[model samples]
Target: MVSQPMPLLNGEPHVGVFIKTASHQVVEVLGAAGLAFGVIDGEHAPIDRSVLDTMLLAGYACRLPLLVRVADGSGPAISSVLDMGAAGIVVPHVDCPEYARQVVAHAKFAGGRRGLSTSPRYAGYGSMSMHEAVCSGDETAVICQIEDPEGVQNAQLIAQVEGVDALFIGPLDLAHSLGADSVREPVVREACEHIARAACGAGKAAAIFLSDPSDKAYYQELGVTLFIIGSDQSMMRQGTRALSSA
Candidate 1:
C-alpha cells in the first residue's frame, strides 16, 4: 500500500475552506477551485454522523483532505472521525500542554489509547494489515485550538507536545478572552503573534481562521501557513450578493 502525501506537510502555504452545509457539491466545487483542504465545521454546525459520512465520502471522491473540528475533545469523538477517514482532527479549546497531549493520544495510536478497528472505512475495510493501519493512524494530523488566554499562555508547551502537528488560533474566542472588541484588536493580534512564534519555534504548523482573505498576508508574515477562510455558506451568500449587485 502506497502512503498518501499530507498536503499540509509540503512546506507550501495551504488554504482551506470551511464546510458547514451537508451538500457534497460544496466539497467538489471547493476541490475544483484549487483549495488545499476542507474543514467540516462539526463544532458549531449541526453535523451528525450520517451527514459527516456523506461529507467524508464526498471528500474521498474529490481527493480533498477533510479535517473535522470535533465538537469536543474526547477519546471517542476523535477516534470516531479518524475511523471514518477524516484526513485529520481539529480539537477545540486545548488550554494546556496536557490537553494538547490528550488530543494527540485520542487521535493517534502511538502511545495513545484510541480504540482500534480494522473494519472502519479508513482501514480499507480490513484490506490493510494491522501495521499499515497503525501507521496510517499515526500519520493522521492532530491540530489543537488555542482559544483561551490560558491556551495562549501555554502555547509554547502545547506546540512542543509530541504528535501534535499544528496549532490553530481561534481569533474570535481569543479576542473575547482578551476583552477585545474584535479579532483585529491589537491585543488579540499580539497573542496570535506569540502563538505563531511558539509554533514556529517548535517546528510545527501554525493555522488560523480568517474571514477576510486580505488578512492572509498579515498572518503569513507571522509564520502561519494554514488559513481556513470562510465557509461554503458564506461564499455562496457573498457570491450571490455580488451577482445581484452586478
Candidate 2:
C-alpha cells in the first residue's frame, strides 16, 4: 500500500515560521508559540551543517516538523539535509517544470539519485532497513519556490510535476523580477494570484512568505493555505521594541 505523505504536504492548511539563526532556543520558542512547522533558512543564513544538525535535533525533540530551505536544489544540497533528518526540503527559484523535477529527483529516492546511507540520523542511525529508509525518503516533502516571472508563468506545469508537493511564492524576489517597487505592488499581487490558481488547479498546496499577518485574508481568498509568516530576526526586532517601550 502507498504510505501517507508528510504532514507539510498533506493538502492541509499549515503555518510555518522561518529561523535565520542557529539557535535551538528559537525553535523551542516557535514550537511553544504553536506554529505547525519551522523552516531553517539555509539560502540566506550562514548556517553550517553542524548548526543545522543541532537545530534539527532540537526540532525533533520539540516534536515540530523542521524543513530546510537549502541554498539551492542541487542533489548534494538536498541529500545532505535529508540525511540530517529534515522533515522535507524547500527548493528555491524553480522556474520550470524541469527544475521542479530536478528538485524531486534530489529529494526523492525512488527515481532520483539521492545517495543511500542507512547510518544517517534520518534512518534511525542504522536502525531502519534500507528499504524502509528509501520509502521514507520518497515520502518526504519537496516544496518548490516560485520566485521569478518564469516560475510564475510555468507554475501550473511545475505543480503538475510528480513529487512536487507545494508551490511557495517568494514575493521579494518576484517583485524584483517584475520590476515592481515593492512586493505589495498590484503586478506582484496578480502574479501571486496566478501561481496560487495554478497550485489549486493541480491539487497542490499554495504557500507564501507573508511579512504582515494582515495580508493572510487576501491570499486565503486566492486559495493559499500554507503561510510562512515572519522570520526569527523580525520577531527579535519586534520583541526588542516592545521591551524598550515598556
Candidate 3:
C-alpha cells in the first residue's frame, strides 16, 4: 500500500449474483444493464483466459468495475487477474491479516513487483504506456472475504491491512461454519453486523451479499455500501418462475 495519498474511486455499490457460468455475451449484457461490478467466478465457475478477456473488455466498455473472486487467495490466478486488467480483485475465504497481506502483494505492482507485462489485455494490449499502467495499479481495489469463524475473529486486522479496500462477509459460509443456516438466520445476521462494525472501525468498507431488493437500502443505511445483492442465476430463476406461472 502506498503511503502517498491516492484518490480511491468507489463506483456505485452494487448487489449482483455469483455468475457461475462463463457466458461472455451474458456477462456483457448484465453489466451494461447495471451492476457496479461483477465478481468473475474463478472460485466456482469455469473462467478461462478467453472468457475473462471478453468479460474484461465488456466491463471496460461499460465503465463497470470487474473483479475476479478467487476461490483460493494468493496464487497463480490472482496474479493473472491483475495482469489481465481487472478493476480489482475479491479474494474469498480470507482468514487473517496474513491472508490480506498476500492479497495486496498479488494485486499491487508497487511493492509486489508483479512482473510488468505490456501488450496485455489489461494494459490495452500495448495501448497504454508502461509507466502509466503501473501508476493506475496503485489505485486498484483489493477486497478480501471474511467468511470462516477464524476470519470473523480476525476481521479487524484483515480490514486494517494497508491495501485492503473492503472486507466482504460471506453470510452463508460463515453461518455454515458457525453451525447455522445462512439465509434469514439470526446468528448469521449478527455475525454480519459484527464484521461490518469491525470493518468500519478499521476504516475499511464493508461488503455483504444481500439477496433481496428491499433489504438493499437497509444495509446502505447501516453504512455498508458494497453489496452483492442479487445474481444472474437468481434473476433467471425468478424470471422462469414468472414465465411458468404465466
Candidate 4:
C-alpha cells in the first residue's frame, strides 16, 4: 500500500515509463523524463545481478522509486529481489487466489518470514532502525500481472488478495492469449477493459501495459494509476528517430 502510485489511488494519476536499458545508463536518464517512477524489468530484459545491484544503487541515488518485475515466482527469484530492497514487485502470470496469497506472503516478513539481512542496500545498509525496515518490508507491494485469458477471467479474485495492491495487464501476453501477436487487437483491449473494471470494483489499482506517451487519456478513462510508458530501448530509438525525421 505504501508503494502504490498514490495519484491513481487518491484520485489523481501519474504517468510513468518502463526502463529496459542497461542498468547503469538508464538510472540517470530515467528520472530526467519527468515521470513518477520506473520498472526495471529484469524478467524480460537481460540484466545480471552484479549490474542490477549497481543499477538499483544509482536508481536510489537519483531518487526514483523502482519496481522490479521478477522473472519468476520461485523462492530465490522473487525473494532475492525483495531482500535486495526493491520498492515493489511485479509478479507475472499470477492466475489463482493461492498464487496471489503466496505473492503477498513472500513479500512480507511477518506474513511469510522472508530472510533478512541488515547490510543490504534496501535498508540503507543498516542505517534504518529494525522496526522501520520491518515495516517497510511488510508493506511493500506484490503487484499481480494478469497477462493471460485465464488470469483475466479470475482478475477480481486475484485483486481481492489481502496484499495485492494492483492488477497489471500485460498487453503482449494478453494478445497472445487471445490468439494474436499484436496488442492493438480488439480482443486484448476488451479483456484489459474487463480487468480494469474488476480492479476498480475490488478497490485495487489497475496498471496498463502500454507505454505510449500519448495514451494518457485512454488509461485515465479506465482508472489506471500506474503507467509503464515505454521501454528504454524504445526511448533510445525514438530519440534518434525523431532527430533524423526532423
Candidate 5:
C-alpha cells in the first residue's frame, strides 16, 4: 500500500508532544485527545525496541502518527525505527549540510542506502510487495535537528539539501551549546529565528520544541509550522502540581 502524505509536510501549522512515558496507552490517549502527532523520545527516554513496537501499533490503531527521536542518527538506527512502522524520525545533532545529506540518504530508499525489508510492521508483516514497501518507506518524514552553533550556521545549506522534510530546533540543547542560560535569551531566540528563516526560505518545514506552549505564536510568526510543545512527563508534573496546590 502506498503511504499517505505526512501532515508536517503539508506546510500547515501542527502541534504535537514528545512521548517520554514509553507507554502505548499514552499514545492512545494522545491520539484520542486529537493531538496532531507524537514523537517518541528515544533520544532521552528509556523506550526500547519492544516498547517502540507496541507504541507504533497503538498509534496506528488510534490514527496517531508517531515519530521517533533517535539517539543515534546512524543509518542502522534510522532504518530500524522506520522498519518498525514509525511515522518518521527526528535525528538529533545534525550540525552540517553533509550530515543532513547523510540523514536523507539513510532515510530514503531511492537515493539513500536504506535496507529493504517487507517483513517489518511497516510493510504490514510481509503482505506488501518490495516496490510498495520501498515507496512507503521513502515517504517517512526525515527531520534533521538543528541544535548546535554549527547547525545554526549551516541551517541554509542543510535546508537546501534534498529529501530533508523539516529542520527541527532543539532549543534547550541549542541554548546550552551557545553558552546561554535560558532558551528565552535573545541570542538563543535570534539563532532560532535564523534557522527558521533558512528552513522556510528553502521551502522546508520549520519545527521547534517549546517549553511554554504560549511561545508557539512567536515562532509561528517566524514561519515555524511544526510545534512540539511539551512532553508526557512534563504534563504529568504540571497536573500533579496543580492538584497539590488545589
Candidate 6:
C-alpha cells in the first residue's frame, strides 16, 4: 500500500512540536492534543533505536505523523529510521546541494541508495511487494535542515533538489553559525527570509522552529508553511510555571 502523505506536502501552515522525551505516552498525548505533526528529537535526545521503535508504534497507533531528526544524517541513520516506519526524516547540516542530494538518495528506494527490505514495519511486515515497498518508502519525507551560512547561500539550489520535501531552518544553529546573539539579529533574520524565499520559489515547504507562537504571522508572510513551535519539555515547563504563578 502507498504510505499516507505528509501534512507538509499540502503547502499549508501546519504546526508541530519536537518530542524529546522517549516515552510512548508523550507521543500519544501529542497526538491527542491536536498537533498537526511531531518530530522525535533523536539528534539531541537520548532516544536510541529501540526507543524510537516504540515511539513510532505509538505514533501509528494514535494516527500521528511523527518524523525523526537524525543525529548524524548518514545513509544508515536515514535508512534505519524509515525502516522503523517513521513518517519521515529531518537531516541536519545539509549545507550544500550535494549533501542535500545525498540525504534524498539515502531516504528514497527508486533511483537511490536506500537498501531494500520488506521485513521492516514500513513494508507492513513483508505484506508489500518490492514494487509496492519502493513506492510507499519513497513517500517518506526527506527534510533537509539548513543551519549554516553556507546552507543559506545554497538554499535556492538545495530546495530545487527532487525528493526533498522541505527546507527546515534550525534557528539556534543558524544563529550560532552566523555568530549572532539571537535569531532576532538583523543578519539572522535576513538569512531565514532568504531560505524561506528559496524554498517557496522552488515550490517546497519552508519550515522553522519558533519559540513564540505570536511570531507565526511574520514568518508566514515570508512563505514559511511549516512551524515547529517548541519541544515537549519546554511546553511542560511553561505549563508548570504558569500553574505555580496562578
Could you tell me which residue pairs clash in candidate 4? 7-12, 211-229
Instruction: Candidate 2: list runs displaced more than 4 Å.
Output: 1-5
For every model shown, what is its TM-score relative to the native structure?
0.96, 0.95, 0.90, 0.91, 0.97, 0.97
Residue-level lDDT for 37 in candidate 6: 91
What are the lDDT figures for the candidates, one per model?
0.87, 0.87, 0.74, 0.77, 0.90, 0.91
lDDT of 3 by residue, 5-98 (tens): 2122353455555665677677777767766667777887777877887776766666666777876775576777777677777888889898
* lDDT leaderboard ranking: 6, 5, 1, 2, 4, 3
Worst 10 residues of 2 by lDDT: 1-10
Pairs with backbone N, CA or C atoms under 3 Å apart (clashes), candidate 2: none
Off by over 4 Å in 4: 1-11
The per-candidate count of clashes, in order, stands at: 0, 0, 5, 2, 0, 0
For model 4, how does the per-residue alpha-carbon lDDT over 111-139 read when each residue is reduced to its tens digit?
A: 67577665566666787777766776766
| Candidate 3 to truth, TM | 0.90
Residue 63, model 2, lDDT: 79
Tens-digit lDDT track of model 6 for 15-104: 999999999999999999988899999999999899899999888888889899999668899999999888899998999999989889
Instruction: Please list all clashing residue pairs in model 1, or write none if there are none.
Output: none
- The model with the greater TM-score, 2 or 6, is 6
lDDT of 2: 0.87
Instruction: Give the poorly placed runs of model 1, Cα more than 4 Å off.
Output: 1-5
Per-model root-mean-square deviation over C-alphas: 1.4, 2.4, 3.7, 2.6, 1.2, 1.1
Q: After superposition, how far is residue 33 of candidate 4 from its true place, in Å?
A: 2.8
